[model samples]
Target: MSANPFSLQSLSRTEAAVDPAFVFDGTMVSRAEFSEKVERTAAWLAAQGIGKGDVVAVWLVNRIEWIALLFAAARIGAVVAAVNTRYRSAEVAHLLKLSGAKLMVVEAAFRAIDFAAILADIARSEVPALQKLAVVGADAVPAHWPSVRFDAFDKPYPPAPTTQEDVDLPVLLYTTSGTTKGPKLVAHSQRTLATHAASVAQALKLDPQRHFLLAMLPFCGTFGMTSLLGFIAAGATIHALDAFEAAPALKILSENRITHSFGSDEMFRRILSLTDAPRPFPHLEICGFAAFQPGWRELAAEAEARGMKLFGLYGSSEVQALFSIACPSDAFADRIEGGGWPMSPDAKVRVRDTETGQLVAAGVSGEIEISAPSRFLGYFNNPEATHEAITADGFFRTGDVGRLRGDNVFVYETRAGDAMRLGGFLVAPGEIEDELKACTGVADAQVVAVDLKGNARCVAFVIPASEPPQQDKLFARLRERLAGYKVPARIYVVDAFPVTDSANGVKIQRARLRTMAMERIAAE
Candidate 1:
């Protein structure tokens, strides 16, 4: 591989040279037009005095303009701090503050979200680092807010491509989904982003000639952003949606002959359940999904019975998404697993026993660790956390429990925190959750272990298919299928489970469920 591919400007230009770079917001953006936007956006960044090492905040949904900002920041050697559109005032404030973003470019209004009002909630002095506000989707800046329109109509590109030509300089920051201690900004340079994209394109076996991917995932997260980068790296065209909806998205996937795309299991289930369109989406060859919400049936098997091809995916903000993926040729049993062979040929995956603190052999469940090219430089401005995450031997402790197959691949299981000890046995909650799903009318199940009177016991939260199931019936079914220890101590019915969005996808907030489960048990 040539070092030429690692250049962000070169990659931008190469991708922009394609006939139609993107179909977004109901209009086709030509290659030349896309290139011009990159130049214009880069020029605007220069005019704003956003030079090397400065952070430019992006707070919008999936749009071509968002992609343009990414290229623009990379071109000017500035770092882009992406803010999730789903975030509210406090979350948004924290991200802007954590990244020390000097300029924030956000849409004035988006659907039901009053972005301007959210901005109003934070006083001018709230984020001291934010110097200027660049508003999109508005004709003029409001009186109270000192801001400029994100209009780069007649701006000129800088005389030179960059003041700093190093691709190793940080160019993007993805915020990690944190709990007790808030989110950490995960920084990645042009080299890592470019190399990882190229490696993923190869691993996915993408060809610009025929393969086209639907950009349904939100670009604020790693899963969405990495897929976008992979498409650009492969010189493939993308059809992007500003916002993802099931009906519209399904229509696009069916009509466009989409060959490769990535999303979550929830997204696919919704699309598949929308309408009986004679098994629609025939051309969808590679639909990589993260099992954010664990289900009873193997989604891949179910999807394959239809025309669509589905496979599991594994990645996080720290290592970046698509670090590993299930191959298209993998059997459904293997395809349903979260972990897969690394996209980078040089990437190393190993397991370390959490209790023994020693590397584990194949088929032994332990912490999944990786030494890969896709790994982030470190948690930005948080050296202590970064030090604790990566081992001295260079492997990143993924904080995920998994077992390596004898081959080069591995299988990701539940999170280390989510794994529970039930009746003196270390157990995966999914095991009990699956059995719970087998009960009559059980749509889904979330099992959590609650410490009850010094003994760890399993508690289940279930969403019904049409109506809540009989608690005694569900418990009886689990008792018949699983061992006495594996059965949930009690089962509770609910309309839906609670979930939170992260760098991965929409994940069920197990901690919240655990709290609810304990309360329910105590009240009984």
Candidate 2:
């Protein structure tokens, strides 16, 4: 590969010309057929007036077409902004508007929410830059907007040619997990994505002989997106699922003879919980997951007993997905305990003192900062936020606390700020607190993450104005306002918050609140 590799057009052409590419649901799509699909999708996008440098928002679940549109956008110079399928009207509108998406490709509905209706409502003023809408699983376009059936855009047009210089241009914009605030768009180029994908594939020892099963994680997320691309780059067969269901996921893992897969500790626990009977996969070799806590360690042991090797991974959207991933040759303890080796030689990781900003000793834990070639360009349309994240000398502050050992392995400790990882997504307690404050009978709200059964669980403490808040009503409000993962597992109403006297001002002592939450849960 050169400094600027050939665009997806050339790569897909070469790969397809050599062998078949993807196997989804039970159907296998040959390389030649996949190339044709990409070309056809690119033609349709061009016909819709989407060309070089344009932004298209994709709101769909994991499927072959989602992957097709990703490469098709790369075939031209257009950028794809992935929207989380779990997002509601407000969340979807904010992403589309912030990314300045000119076109939106979405499904009619996933589960119960009518996405078509939501998109139609937001199209008027929330997302003014949006010009056209193409919907999948819909019979006809809705009235009162410029819309078209996703399949109707298939009128043939020639695939556009791309240059090496264009490969370095922005091609993908993914949203951060909103650890502190609302999600921010992180930009990446074809060069960065390709390099990162290849590095991950090499680290995971992926090959054409392996079959990958993707469940739980959505393609809109960095974790799933990079895994999909890395396996494709390795020419591996893919088995995709729109969502994670224990029985179906287990069936796929056993029936397909899946060799590799990725998921969260909770996801794996659920799959294992389905039955006490031994579920074995002789062909399954590698499994990648997050959160290497004690509970996760037991799960890893159980998985190993059944013939699959589980390893811990540490990364974020800012680092182009997996900055550090466990390799297959690593020891069982190291693979399960450490965050693995850095993906590239060009990537440097170091820890700094939180207050002094001085370099910490190699074995000392502190804030983890990284300088990598595969780092994202910056937060789109927000230079201030970008400057805040990336240091003056080009190092990106990961906001994660970890230590680098003597053997060059990184061990993750915890998040530096109020952010917590729940259900494999980095979430900010403030987001949940905001929703809680909006609830009736709530005067003030404070949220802290506490470890429950080895998974991060949000615990909300409320200060009521009138009377003690009802947990049922507050939970009902949260269900309507936020995603399911953001809903607090336990709620408590108190007269006042625990505070500490400080030189600056009185500050709420979250550590004490966390202790209170733990005691409450333990007592229950």
Candidate 3:
């Protein structure tokens, strides 16, 4: 057995101990076979003189080759930069330059996008840092750059010994949502991410028998990579997807016998819609969700109706998987009403009064802070951001509002990031959305502050059920749950939110919806 303490290399090590003939993507890539492949890739990479601390950017989608590349990077102590496959030329170029990647692995054609053309454009640009580029699943190398096919590179190579620290910097950076700047790079060491995976795997009770169907992107983002690493660390199988679509996902779930899955609240909604037509994915035992907007019960009921239990998960890019609400017992409900139940092991979470910066009572609403070992190292190349996001005591300022319930559970209310003043009072969109979610016929709700006559007004967007949701009924419900001033001044009963594609099952991108709302209001 290898002496490595905490690298993804342990994936093969553990799998070898259990079932070596595990089915990974139809073919049975045994532990011995998988280890040999990883070694071959590592040896090929080492031949290129790519050693410790080198950055290798993977520009492909979810595939066996990608996993090979990732493990290879881990073995050689190279930082793996999982490039977002959705990026266009400009976005791709920016990440390549920012990550300072020395090698890139891509395919000839990905869906409709031409990787060769994009590389050609990038090579023409001023980014002279990139040295080698390999094309996977391609026959001929493009004239723009020297390349080898992914299969041709596969060779019989012996596995090399590596240390616990050898995998320390396997993952270099995370691609943010680009709300303020161009996707600020959130950096993490392998130890940090491995710690995160340990927590997540423990929470899910993942083992070799646990098969998870991944319904998100395959990038360096926390949501994506965490799913990959967490499953791998648990010696489990992960069914990958290029993207999430409801109908196809349902089909895959049923056919693959996928037991566990997760997505944003929007994703659950889409899965619910599929079951609404015909019962889809009856085999799914557990499903997790994060709400960009509140009102998960409808989707939960839909999943339950289809034989799947739904659980709420609260996490962020800074902290991979913070906490989860699996059971809606008194403790869970009370925690949700307050904010969220603390679900992390040894993760110090507290709600601090915004005014005093002092820890608040269990039920009091305050800024949520977390101190955990798995916390991200820092934002890449941005010390000011690192300082601003974390405190002197090492507690990461989550910018979320919540409270704790005793020592075990933590409850969250709203995000400190979205706090805006309205009529000389602080307004929280989550409060408004939660109230709207309680409204009859309102399947889901999301609220954002919009400037009206120089004063912020709550703009509530709702997704109604099959029946036409009565606007008057919803307004009355909000009146009961919220203050008159806090009630959304303007309500829009949208058939579906444009930002959050609930049809796909994930958090609704509020930034996209905010822009759409502004455009629609202007048109009116």
Candidate 4:
């Protein structure tokens, strides 16, 4: 096994060959077998005209095939563009066009959503670069298009030559949840990802003896993918689930004696809410979580009583997943503080004044800026956005407000813009606003995030063009156009919006609207 951690081949070689790498739906795959599958998949992709810099979009749920495709694409120097499985036709079309994907691997259907039908809605002209579509979990390809089954890649093909320099080039493209604007394509190189993975494994104390349970979180996002790769680098066994159902997840945790896992605060709450009786996991050791709310302290204490150490984690797609994590030796208060010390010694963290661009005193909240070796390269095909995000001195502005307590510990505040974290995903109110405004009888719409029992919920205020739009009809329209999570929970019809004077012009006061929403929800 090699010590060099620059490429996928080197990382896989570090793991024990006979160790179990993945256990998906009751089938365990050894590290050696996993490596061989990656090599064979890479060769098949290369035979299909995928080469260095080509984009291969993977649109599947948490499965062994999804993980194999990610590594296989990197092995052949092709970039893997992960498409969120919850995306509708409109969202899927935008990502396909933006990534310029040469090949797409998708599931036949998931949770009763017809993926083939959604793809059929997209015109060929919208994604001219997408040459082929491979359907997974299907007996045969549908007759609507020239598609093939995912298992058709059994024949061997010659592999492409890869170099260390090639490993430094972008090999993965992940979409941001889109806070202020539409989702941007974040590009990450193999070297950057591998370095971050090793750092995360060390911080989390993962090893060959650990068994990790992965559920709910999609591999398309940085959080899940980083954890997946980190566990793989540590030679740990991964137990995967198609979705996050409380009953099934609890059963997996207890039956498998899972040692580690990651999830949002809400996910843990739902699991705990499943029963009044204590669900014990004697082997459970550590669990990393983010987006912690006030109620999480009780849940953390309960999990601790059950022998599980739950800690806070903070990171983003632009920062290569986790730059900060709580150490096991830290105090219980510090562990729940949302952001901990930097995971890597080379990573630098600072809180700077939003207006002056100067470093602020410790304990003072400001924009969180970071300079790290494992940071993402830049946004794909969008140099202007990249330039705006990265500073002149190489620090990336995280768009998050936070403060350093002392030495290295940091506390997270809120987003600088009007973004909100809902169900463990960052979402931009603008996207939902656009959909609402397009509905019949809607003249204008403004969306804001309101705190409801420690959970961020979208509340939309709309001005009708004529008669007020039927709430049920409007919601149905939104359901068809956007993901279910993006739909607003409550809608309020307003005659006009409250505006505030700004330097540029009058702006809608989202903060005021948020207050109004809280009061309204309370009254209801």
lDDT of each: 0.82, 0.75, 0.66, 0.77
Highest-TM-score candidate: 1
Regions of candidate 4 where Cα sits further than 4 Å from its true position: 1-4, 15-18, 139-145, 152-165, 179-181, 210-216, 275-279, 292-294, 418-524
Model 2, position 221, has a per-residue lDDT of: 80
> On a 0 to 100 scale, what is the lDDT of residue 488 in model 2?
91
lDDT per residue as tens, model 1, 108-169? 88789888777777866668888888888776445234688888745464542445467888
Give the TM-scores of the predictions, in the order they appear: 0.93, 0.77, 0.83, 0.78
Q: Per-residue lDDT for 1-524 in model 4, tens only?
A: 22356876666765342267787778888887787788778777777788888999999888878888878887767899988877778878888899999899888888887887888789888888998888887754553447767773465667645533477888889988644456889999888888888877777666675556554566888878887888777777778777666787777876886887777776776776675655477777667787433245667888776566787878888996667877788888788656787777789888887767789888777788998877999999999999999999999999987888876678776577666666665565656886887888888888888877777779899999887799999999988998777888899999988874311123567778998998999999
Instruction: Show where candidate 3 strays beyond 4 Å.
Output: 15-17, 20-24, 120-123, 139-144, 156-167, 209-219, 242-248, 255-257, 271-283, 292-295, 322-344, 420-427, 437-445, 451-455, 461-477, 492-524
Please provide, for model 2 over 1-524, each residue's C-alpha lDDT reduced to its tens digit, 9 standing for 90 to 100: 22345354433422422244666666777776776787788778887889888999999887777878888888778999998877777778889889999998988777886876776566467777988888887854563457787772345666555433477787889887543357899998887788777776666666576556444467888888877777776777677777666787788876876777777776777777776656566777767787422245667888787666787777788886667877677788778764678877678888877767898887776788888867888888899999999988899999887778755568776667656666766564656876887778887788888999988889999988686578899999999888887899998988888875321123567788899999999999
| Candidate structures ordered by TM-score, highest first | 1, 3, 4, 2
Clashes of each: 0, 0, 14, 0
Could you report the Cα RMSD, in angstroms, for every candidate shown? 2.5, 11.0, 4.2, 11.2
TM-score of 2: 0.77
Residue clash pairs of candidate 4: none
Off by over 4 Å in 1: 1-4, 13-17, 141-145, 153-161, 296-299, 423-425, 464-473, 501-506
In candidate 2, position 147 carries an lDDT of: 78
